[model samples]
Target: MDKRRIGEFEVSAIGLGCMSLSHAYGAPPPRDQAERVLKGALDEGYTFLDTAAVYGLGHNETLVGEVLGDRRGDYVLASKCGLSRGTERELNGHPDILKATCEESLRRLNTEVIDLYYLHRWDRRVPIEDSVGALAELVAQGKIKAIGLSEVSAPTLRRAHATHPIAALQTEYSPWTRNPEIAVLDACRELGVAFVAFSPVGRGFLAGGVRDPAKLEPGDFRSGMPRFQGEAFEANLKLLEALEALATEAACTPAQLCLAWLLQKDPIIVPIPGTARPKHMRENAGAAAVRLTDDIIRRIDEQVNETTVTGSRYAPAMQASVDTERTPAEAAA
Candidate 1:
């Protein structure tokens, strides 16, 4: 596996987005199986593992702590704050709340210091400096090694970076969803901050596994997402046909094709595509070896550009948490 720098740490190019095994995709995987997959990822040379306190109300972090706590030195660990778990979940980026959340995350993660700590969302009520300042205090106190911002716009990123150097800006970026290109990507490049691509598989749609959105269980997180509902899903499924052919030509699975495409886009971009099965872990990790030629990439992107993906990446309520990003047409305007 190849390594890239995210702040002070150099981790594997392909990382593990550990949210699915416990939180977002559907029902949580059996504890034993989930543990095996988490451990298997580290053994497979995936040195970057990402989790957040908001995921499963901290269940994901606890699981990772139990499974990988003993092997903490083996990988780079990143977690998030700014999302509260009180009577109702809310974005709270106040300095005091951030401090309390960091302590809680440390206990749940069973770690002395987190390698990368992020403000999961910019709390509208608090200034970016206050949130980032709190993170800087953590860095000074030996609580976290680096700072990251998720779903933030370029101007918000600048404000936070000015408070303290941000290590990375994480958000959704994939072949089907290319919103980061409008401004976020360029902002990170200019500021020398790494861009972490979460949900690089389009929330598992690009992997060809989501054949029917209607089949998703009641509590499934994806069920609430705009893209996974009604006609939008059916339309998105048709778009996959183009990618399927390209993946076939590349001798890779659609999931790996998606990872490889993101990998080839920029050296600073690190994708954390996760799964419940260890076998799938091997396949996702193998994307590092699957090569895509310039022409193949051009053809694949052309197909993506021609196909219009319907539905917002998140529901309207969730979309409010993101700081700054624009549609391609909006950016042009």
Candidate 2:
């Protein structure tokens, strides 16, 4: 795997997201199997691991800690906090709650200091400065090595950076979901912050594993997402056909094609693709080796841009919380 710089630390260009091993995709994999997948990733030279406190409600961190115990320094461990899930699945990011949450994450992760700590979501009630300021304190105390923000807009990113140097910004950025190009990616480039693309394969949909949305379990999170619904799902599958052709030509899987496309987009962009199966894990890791020619990249851009993917990335309520660009009057009000 290739290595890239995220602030001061060097990490694999393709990192493993440990979320699916615990939650979000489907039933949890057995602990031993999940640990094997993690170990395999490290053995294959994936030195960057991403997890969050709320992923399986801290169970994910515990699993990572158990697998990497005592050998933590061998990898760059990145975990997130700040989003509090209440009884009805309400997620909040208040500053005080973030402080308490980070402490809890430290306990669960069993680490003296987290390599990269992030605010999972922006709390509407608290200013971005306050939330980032609290994270700065954690850095001051040696609790965290660097700071990150997730699912935030350019304006909010600038405000948070004024408080401290943010190492990276985590968000969904795939061929199917290209909204970051509107502002977020440009802002990160200007500010010299790394852009971490989560779900770089479009939540496995772009990998050709998800041919039918109806095959998803009833309570699966993707079932509630718009892109996985009836007409939209069918329409999006057509888009994948173009990707499948390119993958075939490239002698790679669709998942790898998608990952390689993102790698070609920006050298600073690191993708954290998640999977619990060892075969899929190895396949994802192999994406770094699939080089894309300039013509292939241009073809991909043209094909993906021509197809209009249906549905919003976030549901209605969650969409309201994303701190996108709003006028000063709207922000103050």
Candidate 3:
């Protein structure tokens, strides 16, 4: 697989989003099975693994540690801090919280130095400088390699970068999820920050895997996303039709086509498409080889245009947690 810069390290263009192995998307694959799947991803050329301290309250990081700890030198490990204990809504980016979180994550990941450490979200209660200053201190201490952010608005990104060079910015940047395009994407480009696209497959909705929200396993996060509920999903599914001809033309699955589209958008854009299935993992990694021509890019634009995208990335309460969009109206506007 080709590599892209996340900081000083060059990671696989198609990184594996390890959250689904234990956090979201219903019951995680059994431990023994998950180990095999993760190993399969590594064998399939994924040198980048993304997890978070908040995911399953550190369960995901532990799983990554247990599976790949022995081969620590094989991949670049990234995790996040700032999420309040056991909750998704509350954020604590205080220096104390960040220091404690960094130590705990190190213990769980079985790594002495986290390759990339991200302030998961902007905390309104905490000043951005304090949070980023702490991260810069961590780099000096050799506790973390590079610093990053998630779902930050353009101004927030600039402010954070001024405190410390933000190596990357992780956010939802799939074809259907265009929030990054509003300003965040361009800001990243201008500042030389690598843009890491999470949920690059639209939680698999854009891949033609999710037909109905009800079909998803109980407790799946997608059920609560505005784009996947009621008329929104029904309308969005129609967008898949626009992708059929292009997928056939590319001789790849709809999911690979989507990955190809993302990779083609910007050399700095790296998509971490997560899946516990070894087959799916291989499929996403293979997308790095998939190429898009001028015509295909135009077709993808038409596909996105064909669907009248509706709904917010999160529910109102969960939406409140995103710093990328200060208000629901602003996101829609």
Name the candidate that leads on lDDT: 1
Q: lDDT for each of the candidates?
A: 0.88, 0.85, 0.86
Which residue pairs does candidate 1 place in steric collision?
A: 153-324
Give the candidate order by descending TM-score.
1, 3, 2
lDDT (Cα, 0-100) at 73 in candidate 2: 76
lDDT of 2 at 228: 88
Clash count of each predicted structure = 1, 0, 0
**Which run of 10 residues does model 1 get worst, by summed lDDT?**
324-333
Q: Give each model a TM-score.
A: 0.96, 0.94, 0.95
Ranking by lDDT: 1, 3, 2
User: Tens-digit lDDT track for model 2 on 53-109?
Assistant: 888887888889988877787899999887653212345566667777778778787
- Estimate the TM-score for candidate 1: 0.96
User: Which stretches of candidate 1 lie above 4 Å from their native place?
Assistant: 86-88, 328-333
What's model 2's TM-score? 0.94
Q: How does candidate 3 fare on TM-score? A: 0.95
Q: Which stretches of candidate 3 lie over 4 Å from their true place?
A: 86-89, 305-307, 325-333
Which numbered prediction scores highest in TM-score against the true structure?
1
